[model samples]
Target: MDAWLYNGKDADDVFGILGIRAEGSRSMNSRKLVVLDEYINLFNARYPSAATDSFIVLRDGFGGEADFARVLSMAKLRPESERMIANTSKYQGELFSKWMVEDMLEPKGVLSTVLEGGSYGTARSEDKLVVNHYNVFYKRRTREQ
Candidate 1:
């Protein structure tokens, strides 16, 4: 199972930009530990197969780092579990600006390339363009062979 978790304010905007709808809610503001526990429980329940994979996408500047830290702590508690954080930034603007070579623009080309292509693409586009302009973090628990 896969889930996209965004801050309440940006949820709708993100959905619109991605041309997809997501369940908008403000749930991560609760205790971080509680959220982590709930995530682990839900993951275990939803993906019972050892070979199945699950992921979560979180927006930066909205307690994303804190939530990722909690996931790391969860990994420590269960050595069999693994978690990783992939952070990125982007400068969104008109389509032409994204492909321009000019040094200065409304969304500076060089800045966009460095932040979006260099960091965001390198991290998230390893497989495919799953989500844009969002930091992706994932946890995996595998059964011992």
Candidate 2:
């Protein structure tokens, strides 16, 4: 994770350049995740010390379920990053989307979540999302915005 964050060679390395900082904590199963402005990052670890990092870029999910489904479909197009997003860490296969919305309501995590039961329009896409288990304020690309 640090490698890509500092190297800037990998596709997700932009996080480092953007001055984004990642804060991580281990789940009961010892898994990790990193979410921030426009991104939902999930970490898969095989050993206690080693982990493979991947992320999903949040798109327009303001339309609720329809937008979530669309964002997920587009996420699948990313053969490399989609691997983690498709893997469910929670019951609804939401990848902690519920918590993301909560984070914003409290700790200012993501402005809103994009899953089936997520909140909408609490924030603008331009707002920076918080990092850790955590967080999307994706730009509005719709005609409505």
lDDT tens per residue, model 2, 2-114? 55434433324443443322211111111232333222232222232433333232212123333433333333333244333433222113433444343323323233433
How high is each candidate's TM-score? 0.19, 0.21
Superposition error at 114 for model 2 (Å): 14
| N/CA/C clash count, model 2 | 4
The local lDDT score (0 to 100) that residue 102 gets in candidate 1 is: 44
lDDT by residue (tens digit), candidate 1, 1-145: 1353323222323324342112111222223323444544555465455211112333232233333323333322333312211111111111223233242323223224433434434543321222221222111111221
Model 2 spans with C-alpha error above 4 angstroms = 1-33, 37-62, 82-92, 95-145
Tell me the whole-model lDDT of each prediction, alpha carbons only.
0.28, 0.30
